[model samples]
Target: MRVLITGGTGFIGAEVVRQLVAEGGHDITVFHVSGSQRRLADVADRVTLIRGDVGNISHVLDAVKTARPQAIFHLGAILSTASDLDPSAAMHANVNGTFNVLEAARILDVPQVLFASSIGTYGLGMTGPHIDDLTVQRPLSFYGTAKLFGEGAGNFYRHRYGLDFRGIRFPGICGPGVRTPGAAQFHSWVVEECAKGRPYTIEVAPHTRVPIVYVRDAAAGVLALARAPRERLVQFNYLINGVPPTPSAEQLADAVRARVPGARIDFRVDPQRQAFIDRLMKPVDDRFAREEWGWNPAYDTDAMLDDFLAELAAHPQRYPD
Candidate 1:
């Protein structure tokens, strides 16, 4: 399979590229903006890398034309914190970038396009303990709004153009070397800091809970969805949960302490950040993803932590202090 991945040098995107290289049949092209390719250095020899921004239609068109990919995994976008900081930049990157990818795929006759959506698509005023695939999406942040728009646009492309457009609404993706600044990022940093024998603080309250997926599971789940039989999919986009039973801040900290003896983990609540989490901490129901496409995560919390630490230890250069 010939595949092109936007944002293929990012955290999850890098993992996807690595996995594809390991799987051994596909020819992969990574489309990314100018920046460090450190995340992909290990697999750099195996895949083709292209420098470009998804927000630019010309760049998108050229990438698709050159790669002639059968599949395009559209993972490029402005994340929450950055989006909130500059809404205009977010609009150009997140919203326009998605449109550019979809249009390019349609024009170039790409058979399948997989989108990366987010839990932020569901916001305050949601009236359920767990938000499912069918829940109304009224995203509070510009980032979430853009993701929701991607879902809608993908559905439109699927129905109107006979494109195999699929998307996954992922929860907080946790793993090693998460440098992105966001309220939920602590889920990753707590473990990473502890693994480095450095003191880490949980900004949110101890009891605050949120769903998270290990980065590897996230990459696998999206790829699995992309490869599933099209007829089996009742919906174009699906919500997916990672791990089981969402963990509180304290529970996660305790888990880390258990693994790394004498790990220093403390909580000093940031009311503003806690409020941000409180509004969007509901568990997600991904039954549709499981039943329709056989989505199953390989790691539980403990296993995820173990592998995360091992990766940081083994590849200390990949994630530097």
Candidate 2:
């Protein structure tokens, strides 16, 4: 089956590409912006790399025609910080970008589309208890607003055009790949910094808790929903909680320190940064995804950190000399 993944060169998208290629025999096309980070360097030969913007209808239409993919993983979007700073850019990339993808899929009759939505869509001021599929989302950032809007558009496409749309609300995804710029950078940023034995300032308070997922598991969740039987998903969108290793910032720091002796961590809270991180770190239940699609993450917080350090340690040269 041919699969076209927008933002296929990103952290999660790169893992998705690896998983798909490892699974074998599927034609893959990566839709990338002109000068965006190209994380798909390893699979350059395996995937049909197409340069285009998901915000443009013609770009998407042409890619759709060229790939003729049965499934689409729509992972393209601006990050929380970037969106908050320049909402117009976020709107163009997230909202308009999603519209283009959904419209193209509707026009081409793509079988399934796994749209990437963030836990940030859960809104600001969430206190206690894990958010579920039924939780009301009062997004506090443009990025979240755009994601929520994308979910709504996906629902519209599904109901109006019979397009199979599946939305996955992801936690902060972390792993060894291209470093993404966003408010949630704290999750993987600290890990990378600590692994390199480099001192870094943590933007959030130590106790700030947020859900996180290893890139591999996040990609796995997407693939699972993409391959799930359409009849199984009665609900339009699925909120998947990737396990929060230990939401405490100190706990994450300790894990890093333990891995890299004498790793330095200074607490310097960025108010605006904290706002975005707070929502994602809020406790949210994922029983819906579990009951609906048997979705469960393979790594806990400790496991994720261990895996991350192991990967980095195995290849010390991957980082700057």
Candidate 3:
């Protein structure tokens, strides 16, 4: 399969690219901003990297036409912190960016589109011990709002045009090499910083809970969704809870301490930031994803932490202080 991945140099996109390379039979074209190949180090040679902004339809259309990809992974967006700082940029990158991808797919008759949505869609109103598949989306932030729009728009495309658009609602994705400035990103930041023997303070509360997925499992889940028969998909997108029974900051920090001895990880609860995340922190039921497309996480918190530390150790060059 020929694949086109926007934001292919990003955290999750990089892992998705690695998985595609490991599978060994696909031509991958990465549509990234200004051709930053920094995060795409290992697989850079294998992929055809194109410089383009998804916010610009022309840039997206050009990449799609050039790659002529049968499968498109639409993953580019301005994340939480950046979005909070300048919502206009988020609108441009997240809202318009998603639209451009859908338009390109529709215009070119692309077979499939795999979108990366966020759990943020179920914002402040998600007051529950558990968030089921039927929860309504009332996003609190500009970032979440744009993501919700993408979800609704993708579904519309699927229904109106038979566009094979499928999406996954991700939580706080944790792993090494995440440079984006999202509030919840501190979850991953703590782990990565600790691995490098650097002291760091988490901004969220010690006991605040949140959904999380390891980078590897996140990428695997997306690929599995793409492989499933479209007929099996009763809905256009599915929720994926990577770490169920969602771990707390303290739990994750404790795990990091246990793995990386002498690591110093502290915290202070920023009420504002914590509020936004807490609103979307309910236990997400991803049984739909499991039954629909055989999505299963390879690592639990324990397994994930172990591998995280090990990977950082083996590839210290990957994460510099």
lDDT of each: 0.91, 0.81, 0.86
- TM-score for all predictions? 0.98, 0.92, 0.95
State in Å the error of residue 44, model 1: 0.8
lDDT, candidate 3, 10-59, per-residue tens: 88898899999988989999999845566668778998999988999999
Best by lDDT: 1
Those runs of model 1 whose alpha carbons end farther than 4 Å from true positions after fitting are: none
Candidate 3 segments whose C-alpha is farther than 4 A from its true place: none
| Candidate 2 lDDT, 1-321, residue by residue in tens | 899999887767877898999999999999878464445555689989898988889999999999999999999877777888999888889999999999899889888788999887877556657678888888877888999999999999888898889999987777764354776677788888867777888888888876777888999999988887777776768887667444677888887787778888888999977875654556768887887787989988778888888877775543432
Between candidates 1 and 3, which one is better according to lDDT?
A: 1
Candidate 1 RMSD to the real structure = 0.9
What candidate 2 gets wrong by more than 4 Å, as runs, is 34-38, 124-128, 177-181, 275-281, 314-321
TM-score: model 2 vs. ground truth: 0.92
Candidate 1, residue 135: Cα displacement in angstroms equals 0.9
